[model samples]
Target: MKVIILAAGYGTRLFKDLKNDRNEQFKHLIGVPKPLLPIGERPLISYWVEALKVRDDISDIFVVTNNHYHHKFKEWAQKYPFVTLINDGTSSNEERLGAVSCLQLAIDKFQINDHVLVIGGDTLFYEDFHLHNVIGQFETIVKDNNYANLVLSYPCKDEETRKYGILETDENHKVTALREKPSPTDTASRQACPCFYVLSKDSLTCVQTFLDEKKNAPIEEKDAPGHLLSWLVGRNPVHVYPVSGRFDVGNLESYITCHKYFQQNIRNIPTYLQ
Candidate 1:
């Protein structure tokens, strides 16, 4: 399987907070992309890159970023010859193609025909979350159904359902449906779904199929991968892989928290990069 890291978000919320200066400590971070922001000893996305770089199951790692941060990612990508970067030709959030569109761009540009492992650049799971285990589970799913897909899910608080896309699964753990940012009372399921997924190679073309079918739909409908995941659950066998927890560094506070978590649990960090 190949890997695609979605990092094109404009970081509006974090930029707003950093622009407030916060005693001038955040001045340096004013315009950095969330995925490139410093976390612990390295950039946030670097942790994911380092972990996957060592895996033979992964073929190539592609990072899709907007033109605004293209130069910045170019500088970073210089150190890793194994990674390829795609400039989505969008400089701002309003001009940006949503996450799913960005994925389509990368797939088209690279002509990716293999199974792809999709990861959110600004998202990080707990120290105990292992890609080895995740990939193993995904492989098991594929063994039963080659067209099946796997996504990571972690339990979230009842009141926090509004903050994420929740998953509804059957007794067999197959995703029955997805409610994007549903109200806490909308459903009893609290299986907060993250952006991480292992999409089968045979199902790769379905992304373009979705975009074409929803050609006239509002951008909001095609923005998040959850929309596509929900669409996939209907036609394909989408299963859930439970994770303990994850840190989505969307704001300054969450970024700091993710950094501190890594710092305090240094030993748990993967060392495959060395």
Candidate 2:
């Protein structure tokens, strides 16, 4: 499977938190990209890369980043044998392809025929390595039923649910509905759609549909995996597998909190350069 990471966003909202007047994404965070910013002493994205490296399911890792950071990402990824870096080719979001478009790049680049695992670049995942467990959750629906898309969901705090695309599932754990930052009346559950996704090869065709239908407008948060999943649910099965632990670190609060939380609680993150 190819793992595609969406890292092209300008991170405008994240700018204040990530860079001061002196620092940019390329500047050293104890000597790493700000996304490579360390939690303990190891780079943040390193942990995610390490997790994927151990998974026999992942064959190649593709990270789509802005042009300014392409060299930096290429440099950072050099330590890992399987990682590939693709430049988004410009600094402006208008010039860069959105999350779904990045997947398109990966598909075209690799001539991929198998399923792809796509996740937000800013997230930190700490799930136990159980490929069978992950596959088991969606196998019956995905293979036997031949579903086209799948997403990972987890029970999140009600307050935090407001920040994510909340999912509603039937008793069978099949996603029945998705609400992107739904109002009080719209949401039925606190099960949040995190940024991770397992997409079937057929789903790329759906992405083509999106390109034909929605390409005129600039891509936004609404145009990503959430919209893609919601678009596919009735037409095709979009499975959901619950992961035990993960965190989206986009700003200072989540950055510090997830770092401290994981370091103290989840398994110890290595100190590679310190």
Candidate 3:
């Protein structure tokens, strides 16, 4: 299995918050990339790197970032020789390629044919998230059917449903449908789908097919990776793995919240610098 980390986003929301802040403490983070922002003693993206290093099945790790922060990512990747950084050739948010396109870029650049584990560079899970267990579930599903894919989901509050991609799963944990940021009354399910995904090699081609089909559509339709998964559920066998919680560092409030949690409970975290 190989890992693909999507860090190409321009983080316009976070930048806006930081730019308008009156506090002097946040001045240093004005231009920092979300993934490279300090979480504890190390950068946020380093946590994911440390976690993947312990997995024996994971052979190669690829990080896709835009040209704006490409140098920063390349400098960080020096510590882990196994990681390869790819530049999407976009310098700003407006020209940036979407998450799904970045994933496809890594696949084509590396010629990866094995199972691909996709993760968001700005997202982190609680201590209960075990990569081995998720990989085990993927293996089990593949044994039953080669095209099966696995994604992580967590329950969100009713009011928070519109902020994420909500999922509805059958009794067997198979995803029945995926609605991207639907209204609260649109569905009864509160399962919010994160960016973590384990895609079988056979399903990689499906990504390109989806993009080709949506080439002429609005950019919003092809931006978020959930949009692709929303379309993928109907055509492929996708399963959901529930977890306790996850922290998506999109804005200043979320970044501070995640930093406090990691700073206070760093020792108890199974995946923290291990």
Colliding residue pairs in candidate 2:
none
Question: lDDT by residue for model 2 over 1-274, one digit each (tens)?
Answer: 6778777666554456556534353234422334666675566777667767776777888887788677777778779867888786776756767777776777777788877777787776554534456555545566766545667777777677667788888887788888887765667688888777777776667766766677676567434667766766767777677766567776666767877876686554442111
Instruction: Mark the regions of model 2 whose C-alpha exceeds 4 Å error after superposition.
Output: 18-34, 126-132, 221-223, 268-274
Give the range where candidate 2 is weakest over 10 consecutive residues by summed lDDT: 25-34
Whose TM-score is higher: candidate 2's or candidate 3's? 3
| Candidate 1 per-residue C-alpha lDDT over 1-274 given as tens digits, one digit per residue, 9 for 90 to 100 | 8999999999998888787755887789887888888887889889888999888888899999999999999998888889999998988888878899999999999899988999998898875678888889999999999899999999999999999999999999999999999999899999999999999998898999999988898887777889999888888899999988899998888877888877777664656222
Alpha carbon lDDT of residue 139, candidate 2?
Answer: 51
Better of 2 and 3 by lDDT: 3
Q: Which has the greatest TM-score?
A: 3
Instruction: List the candidate 1 regions with Cα displacement exceeding 4 Å.
Output: 271-274
TM-score, structure 2 vs. true: 0.85
Best by lDDT: 3
Q: Provide TM-scores for the models.
A: 0.96, 0.85, 0.97
Better of 1 and 2 by TM-score: 1
Query: lDDT for every model?
Result: 0.89, 0.68, 0.90
